[model samples]
Target: MARATLIGFSAVAMWALLALLTDASGSMPPFELSAICFAIGTCVGLAARIFSPPPPVRERIPPQVWLIGIAGLFGYHFFYFTALRNAPAVEASLIAYLWPLLIVLGSALMPGEKLAWNHVAGALLGLAGTVLIVTKGGGLAFDARYGFGYAMAGVCALLWSSYSLLSRRFPEVPTTVVTWFCAATSLLSLVCHLALEETVWPEGAVQWLAVLGLGLMPVGAAFYAWDIGVKRGNIQILGAASYAAPLLSTLVLIAAGFAEPSWRILAACVLITGGAVLAAKSMLFGRDAKASAGAGA
Candidate 1:
């Protein structure tokens, strides 16, 4: 439970940093930014290896691991940025938080974990919370931008689900290898963004600072820390804890002046927090922290 709490906070902090950085870099394309972060992360990973790398991170991996995971990762980052860049943060975040709910069905259908009624109930609560945010604490109609943000977020979630289900096949692989894959897939995203969208480099120091933050904090430092937490803890703990990220990021946005404080955001936070708590309770009953902590293996 404590580990989950820590991971949740950590995820929130990372997302908050990510939101601030992106907002800082005005009109910086997501894929190009992704390429920057990935490129920087690759360098960091390489340097770590040179200094004190983990032993070679390969084993007998199924061919499908690379094929499925690579494609899904590529799609997830691409769509995630598109949604963030095109829509409002609060809107995009609420939509993206649907991932935890999606994971229930994901576990049942694709990964073969049964989806229970409690899961449905929790998801509904979370959904309601998001609706509250959209309405600004009451009732608001969905607009095109909001609708598109959700659609993009949905795609991101689906891709993430695919990646999650497939990651079971590559348990022994090293973090550096995973980082490499992220960098590799991100290159495709960069190409796609350049082809489909306006690509621009940061012109001034502010934009450059944003880019640096994306690479160092969001992509490099935070991701590396997340990997450390996951490796040290359980996937259930990591996943459940991660549901708190949206709430944390929203607060960060408000603080950074990128988003205004509103009841809707607060409502969504409560809903996400409460629902995640319920899910955590279920996991607690099923498995102890020490037990679940080893779930990654």
Candidate 2:
């Protein structure tokens, strides 16, 4: 349990680096960065596959899983990079953190998953947090130029939330199958990059370092660690802890001199994290109630 918690924390740290790294990805088109980063991740996945064999033929994954998962993964990163490109890193990241809340709400749609009142309440709280962040604490003077980027970040949240729900529906799919997902996302990102952006590699060593760091840490090994932690660790704690990614990322950005800490950001964090805790209360603490309700039904 301790080891799993450590690994989960490490995964969260890696995820926390994503926003800062993406912000440092200067002048690289979003699709281009997506292709390059996922390509590196594909290599990592392939190497993992080589060292550790896949499941037997009887447990082969379906094409639909591949399509849906790859689409979600690729789409999330694509828009994520775009969001960082156009919007403030802290704000964009805070908006994207809405995924966890979305996941809790979306889960109710799954078979046998009930829509508890806390879930709706949490969703509303999260939405309010988003509004606070997006509106800059109700000042109401938003930059229209960044609207597309903000919208893209919202789409990123939806993509990841949907992906997570779909993954729950296909729990039989092995974690090792992420190799295929990396491969497919790499291919799609490549096509998009080639068609939409000019062929330009990282401009300098700093950018190159950022790109490599992103591919290896956030896109590559973080997912592996998360899988291990979720399979072996206290998942409820990890789920709650995952909300810290944006907060940590924002701190890292401020530390790196990219942005300044502000009241609105802190308030948004409070609201979002508070809402996540509220929404997850039943899952974390209401096991007796859940079982009793089920038995009664």
Candidate 3:
């Protein structure tokens, strides 16, 4: 199979896992959910690092590599959470998902990338789909508070894109180290969760299960697959493929019965899928040329 196809499927799988975890979190305290995700993720990362045969050391990574990742991970959670706090879910989601557009803009600053008119149109179409997802069936009537939230999410989106770009700087360092940093950063989140979200322990086995699931999937595994995809495939193609995350997430939500199978949702999925295909087809079609291969855990 083509490398791009594999990357695309794994990326979409991560989004589905995220959506499934959200449904799982319903019975759990948010803290437990957050804690277990980070904690187990840390463990999983450590295990992977210990057992895997090392590749040629990319370079002697300095402490600054970790420091940057730690900071970036903190910003990712901080901005996302604060955005949710400052605005409604719908508006916040719309703005937060704009990270790819931020990527498009940031490409000029990065090496070997350019933003073309096709990129802009693809981004706009994805944004329109996001608006539909965020508003649900309500359409685009947004309040000032929600607008503020969207702006905050916009900030978070840029921060994330910056992090994604910066990730290239730490090539040889195990992804687990960064995941560990992210886990620790959630200490700050843990404190906030205590103060604002209330309660500490998960209520029951069901909640515990939810927490475990989040940790294993999004926190532990998805990123590992993504890192591999970066190494083995085209970065530009993978970046474009990320637009599918939101679309696949919607499908997961529908399967969980949180959302109906509506026409708008269907249409949004079509637009996103088609755009992703356009954006990624080159990497996909030339399978022999860029045959990326990875084992998804």
Candidate 4:
């Protein structure tokens, strides 16, 4: 479980590069870019399959698993892009990032899971840090005009959190199944691109390389790692730690000269790091700590 949770953190680390890579990929339409990157992501999974083939039982994965997998990947992205289009980026993103907190809260419903005080506190602290990062300590004034977009962002949060939780219920399902989900998402994204967006391909070698980088990291292997983590890892810790993505992303942007440094970013780093440590207190200490925590609860 610890190893799987660490693998999940790798996904968050890869996601930190998403903003930098997308910025470098030029002004391609969202769906078009999604299609292309996910196509490469599909190829990535295929290459892995060639190296280590999954068992025959994995081939007989249930239909509901496929449905949930595709819906989670494609549905979350589609709504997220739509929300960004319809609302202010800062507001939309802040709302969408509630998935981690939602996951922490929702985990109580999972079988044999305990909703501890530290878990909730850690999640809330992470959310506070995320808010600082997303809003840059500025006030949010949500206008009535963007209500639909705000609602879409809420849906994005629910979809992703539910997806992560639901994945836990199907521990028998292999992570390799994510490959098919990526393939289906790529195809669906292509269809959406054709219908709703003008064709605008990546321009130069740099842009092309950026696109490939996105596919190989954030969009590709990240999902695979996440699948394994959510199915068999310490989900509460994963939920709290997920907030580190935005902080890491902001730092990456600053390092790449795409964003300016701010005191808020520094503060967010402290809060997020502290929250992760607090959430993982049991794992860091020992099973005796966990027993004590459970007794207190």
Candidate whose TM-score is highest: 4
lDDT of model 2 at position 83: 91
True-vs-predicted CA distance for residue 74, candidate 4, Å: 0.2
Model 4, 189-208: lDDT tens per residue? 99999999999989989999
Tell me the tens digit of each residue's lDDT in model 3 across 43-131.
77778878978666655667776666666666666777778877877767777887876765566566655555555556566666666
* Candidate 1, lDDT over the whole model: 0.63
Please write out the lDDT profile of model 1 over residues 116-192, one tens digit for every residue. 66566565666676556544664444578467777898788777655655553344655555566667766786787
Clashing pairs in 1: 107-113
Error of 4 at 48 (Å): 0.8
TM-score per candidate, chains pooled? 0.75, 0.73, 0.83, 0.95
Weakest lDDT window of 10 consecutive positions for candidate 3 = 288-297
Q: Which 10-residue window of candidate 1 scores lowest in summed lDDT?
A: 229-238
Clashing pairs in 4: none
Provide the clashing-pair count of each candidate structure: 1, 0, 0, 0
Score candidate 3 by TM-score against the native.
0.83
Residue-wise C-alpha lDDT for candidate 2, range 81-175, written one tens digit per residue? 77988887656766787776676666666775666676667666656766665555654434777888789889999987777667656756766
Better by lDDT, candidate 4 or 3:
4
Candidate 1, RMSD to the unseen true structure:
4.3
